[model samples]
Target: MVDPLLLQLAAAGAAIVGFGWLALAMDVHWEQAQGQRPQPAPVVRLLRVLGSLALAASLGLCLTADHASMAVLVWFMLLAAAVLTVAMTLSWRPQWLRCLWP
Candidate 1:
């Protein structure tokens, strides 16, 4: 089995990317990050799929690190953290998020 700390860290990364992708799928956030008006339909679709998969991967990693009961709680906390991080980044420095995709 992988080290719990490593797995948890990976989970955090996946969650952050997941939320970031979800935010970028939105026109406003995409414009903020991409400096454009409206994202392409195909890119939006792909982003949504990738975002959901990343979130699922994050949960899987969390489960691998802890008991199922605790994993759910931990996943939620991680999700919250990821959301805040993404939101703050988007608000303050959306260009940083460009690295996530571009």
Candidate 2:
């Protein structure tokens, strides 16, 4: 069986990566991270799909790591943290997000 703590950490990482991908899918955020380049439609769609899958993976990891109620609550909290981390990274230093897409 997978270690619960490891799974929790993986869940958090996945949530962050998921949010980063989703943010980069947006025109404004994409421009911030990868300036002057034309945003490709196909890449945008691919990023959106990958981001959604990562989020679902995070939820799955969370559920596997804990009881149902706790897992839901923990996952919600993880989402909040992930959103803040991505937003701050975007505003403070969006170039850092390039790693997510590239």
- For candidate 1, lDDT tens digit of each residue in 1-102? 689999999999999999999999898899899896557899999999999999999999999999999999999999999999999999899999898778
How much does candidate 2 score in TM-score? 0.97
Q: Residue 5: error of model 2 in Å?
A: 1.0
Candidate 1 structure lDDT: 0.94
Scored by CA lDDT, what does every candidate get?
0.94, 0.96
Error of 1 at 52 (Å): 0.3
Task: Report the C-alpha lDDT of model 2 over 44-83, residue by residue, as the tens digit.
Answer: 9999999999999999999999999999999999999999
Q: What is the lDDT of residue 8 in candidate 1?
A: 94
Q: Model 2 Cα displacement at 11 (Å)?
A: 0.3
How many residue pairs clash per model? 0, 0
The estimated TM-scores of all candidates read 0.96, 0.97
TM-score of 1: 0.96
What does each candidate score in C-alpha RMSD? Answer: 1.0, 0.6
The best candidate in terms of lDDT: 2
Task: Give the range where candidate 1 is weakest over 10 consecutive residues by summed lDDT.
Answer: 31-40
lDDT of 1 at 89: 99
